[model samples]
Target: MFRLALKSLLNRRGTVLLTVFTIALSTALLVGVERVRSEARSSFASTLSGTDLIVGARAGTVQLLLYSVFRLGEPTANVSWATYQQIAAAPAVAWTVPISLGDSHRGYRVLGTTGAYFEHYRFGNRQPLAFAHGEPFAGVYEAVLGSEVAAKLGYSLGDDIVIAHGIGRVSFSNHDDKPFRIAGILAPTGTPVDRTVHVPLAAIEAIHLDWQSGTRLPGRGISAEQALTHDLTPRSITAFLVGLKSRVATFQLQRQINEYRGEALSAILPGVALQQLWSLTGVAENALRLVAACVVIVGILGMSTALLTTLNERRREMAILRSVGARPRTILGLLCLEAMSLTLAGIVLGVLLLYAILAAVRGYAASQFGLFLGLGLPTAAELYALAAIFSAGLVAGMVPAWLGYRRSLSDGLAVRT
Candidate 1:
């Protein structure tokens, strides 16, 4: 029966191939979308590492994180400098690195932070930032560029670049035109750090001495050199990354931040806050999966349609098999085998195609999106999804096979009327 099934399917290879390719495309899309989502979640989660808490003004925690770490959104309000000093001086705080955002050189974000950032901040599970060239920013105007910033802009040590006032694509305000001397360039970290340009908080204040909000002073202006003599004290910063001296002090500090008497500020554990943010965005994630699954389903439907249409052409073939003393069960097995075979072929082809795609794109995705997609073994969930697809294909084939078998019996020993 199996031999006959193989011979029969081979004879119908033209139609079978079309069906297989159809199912293959569907399976690949379903698997690919799901894998992308899972990996992206992991990538986003990796953005927050080793930091116990993030303290910022009383706005959305998600917004605070986006501006503080990801540089995607505007800060609702800046936390007071005095408040940050208090938070840093808290008994529970081990080290605090203040971040002043909303400036960018060309396209990369400018992070005005202290040297403690290079020492205490961590990414991707406590990995430290390493210098690719030169040292950390030592003076107010010295800058450290992330790997992306350096590579994209072709920046190197001792290079000078001017920053713009706002974070977006278009901003009218320019910094006091004092170019920042590139003190260092960092090795690629694959986190948001790889896209940032770091400078001292004093430099941030210095750039905006004559600016208000996001605009330049209009009539009041100072050359980058003239601004040097002025006291560039930062009135506020976007947020502060906090590491606790003891694990026990986390709850205490969160309580302190939430109940602070002077200012409306809040503190959040990075991991917990990330979890909450993901939950809020989970709907869109699942919708992506569903949309991919639907696309694959359409392909499977194409496979079914191809098989059903070809049944008419295979009528004589089935009649010949019955005449040759093949049992009804044998005929049924033949149809099922053909369906299963097509599905297997589709699956194998799709896997190869997916591999080729990933190989072609691994470097680009890593460089552009900071997402590292490994072509290693598929996760267990992925395997399950694949298995489900395989089984579904087999079943889809079985339906047409059964119909052919019935037609064979109903018209045994003769062509249909």
Candidate 2:
């Protein structure tokens, strides 16, 4: 019976092929969206794997995360160096990495941090930052480039690059005199770290010495050498990553930072903040998934249309089968089986296409956008989605199957013109 059904489908190979392609594309789109969304979440969650809390000036948790972690926006205010030191000195705090921003090299963000950043920072399952070529910055006028920065700008160790006055790509006022040598190039982490430029905290202070009130002082220049001679201690820092001595102390430390009388500050659990951010953006994610679901429904509807339209052409074939004692029930089952088969084929094809495309572009996406897509098997949710599509296909076939059953009964063994 299955062989006969396959033969009948092959006879209408043109329409069958077209329907298969339509369903295949829809399946690919649906599965691809889910895959990308899952990977994006994973990549984002892994960005600060080992950090216990992120402390920043009083602002929205999402805002602080964007500036401190993703380099998305400028901080509203800075935590005073005194405040930072106090937080670091807390008994519950095991370690802290001070971060100072507001500087830029070309268009990439310049992150002023201590050597402790490289030592304590982790991503993607507590993975430490590995050097691609050289060690971390040691000298005052030295900088370490992220993988993306080095690859995009064609920079290498010992290369000299100047910092811009602001974060803009086209800044008129460049710190031309304080050129920094590329001290190191970090291996790709498939996170925001891949896009940042790391320099000593002193470098951030050194570049701003000649400037007063966000503008260069008129006719008073402080060369890099002269600036280094002065106390380059930062008075304020944008934020700091904190690791607690024990997991039990997390809430205690967070409460202490939030209520500190020294300065208005906020300390957030990174995991909690990330979940909140995801929830805020859940609407868009759901919208994308809904659109993909609609596409799958349209594809199933198309299969139904193709089968119903072809029923009239198959009337004579149905009559011949009835003459040979084929039951009306058999005819109905055949149509249903054909629809399910087509859907299954399309799903298999779509999955293959999805992975093939991912395998081809995974490296580029990681290097350019820091989005790492694994070539792993589909998750449980994806498998369930595919099963749902298959079930929908069967349900969609019921309409054409009913029609075929009714016609076979009415036109039993009759020759139709």
Q: Tens digits of per-residue lDDT for model 1 on 58-92?
A: 87777777778777778778899988897788777
Per-model TM-score on C-alpha atoms: 0.93, 0.95
257, model 1: CA deviation in Å? 0.3
Off by over 4 Å in 2: 360-364, 409-417
**Model 2 Cα shift for residue 398 (angstroms):** 2.0
> Each model's C-alpha lDDT?
0.82, 0.90
Candidate 1 residue 354 Cα shift, in angstroms, is 2.6
Candidate 2: lDDT over CA atoms? 0.90
lDDT of 2 by residue, 267-338 (tens): 998899999989988998899999999999999999999999998778878878877888889989999999
Q: Which stretches of candidate 1 lie over 4 Å from their true place?
A: 1-6, 218-220, 361-369, 407-412
